[model samples]
Target: GIIFFGSQMITRDWIFNEFGCKFSITIDILCTVVSNFQVIVYTVAALSVERYIDAKLSLTLNNKFRTIITITCIVLIWTMGLLMPLP
Candidate 1:
């Protein structure tokens, strides 16, 4: 995200050709979308934990199950992030 913004700021006149400009914009958009989605996911996770504690629910999970759930959530987040940039 910083890379995209910094590049644009440093080259206000656009040093790259048309293709470069388009590619840079695409990357910027992808980064922005992914970061936004991550923020949403993190916020939800935090809220879920807060609610769970408030309700005094069990927070226990087997190691394997926890790993699987974490991996699945990461994959889903990235998949959704990448798909969001599509036209």
Candidate 2:
């Protein structure tokens, strides 16, 4: 598979002290890619919640609490996405 070769290349094509970390990276990529659908679902859920907040009330989104909460949700979603994999 393309993924397998790409992962193997990182380990085989380069010399490093990682002791075939590329293999781990390959597996991680496969796992993460396969798991991405779930991630997208979560993202859509977050967006839906945001939409509900925007429609549920009459006040414009100028209040500190609403603004902060919206920003928090957005940031949390992205942060988790970025940090989803670690060894």
Candidate 3:
């Protein structure tokens, strides 16, 4: 995210060759997508679900179950985030 914003700020008045420009733009887009959608959005959702489970099923939910659930959510979030850009 910082890289994307920094590149934008630095490139405002500068110019790059064809390959450099394309590579910079690709990095910016990839960073923006992963930072905004994958990390922030999905993480919040996962935390919310975890909290809900903890609150509602505190007695039944053990550390092992919670760990499994958390890992599954993380994997799903990354998988969805990465696959979303694909056709």
Best by TM-score: 3
Lowest-lDDT window of 10 residues in candidate 1?
53-62
Error of 1 at 77 (Å): 14
In order, the Cα lDDT scores of the candidates are 0.67, 0.68, 0.75
Q: Quick one: best lDDT, which candidate?
A: 3
- Number of residue pairs clashing in candidate 2, backbone atoms closer than 3 angstroms, sequence gap of 3 or more or interchain: 0
RMSD of each: 7.3, 6.3, 7.0
Alpha-carbon deviation at 50 in model 2, angstroms: 1.1
Query: Which regions of candidate 3 deviate over 4 angstroms?
Result: 1-31
Off by over 4 Å in 1: 1-12, 57-87
The collision pairs in model 1 are none
Query: How badly does each model clash, as a count of residue pairs?
Result: 0, 0, 0
User: Which is the better candidate, 1 or 2, if ranked by lDDT?
Assistant: 2
lDDT of 2 by residue, 1-87 (tens): 344457558877644336456665777777578457546866899888878887986386767878798788777776676556433
Candidate 3: RMSD to truth: 7.0
Give per-model TM-scores: 0.52, 0.50, 0.60
Weakest ten-residue segment in model 3 by summed lDDT: 1-10
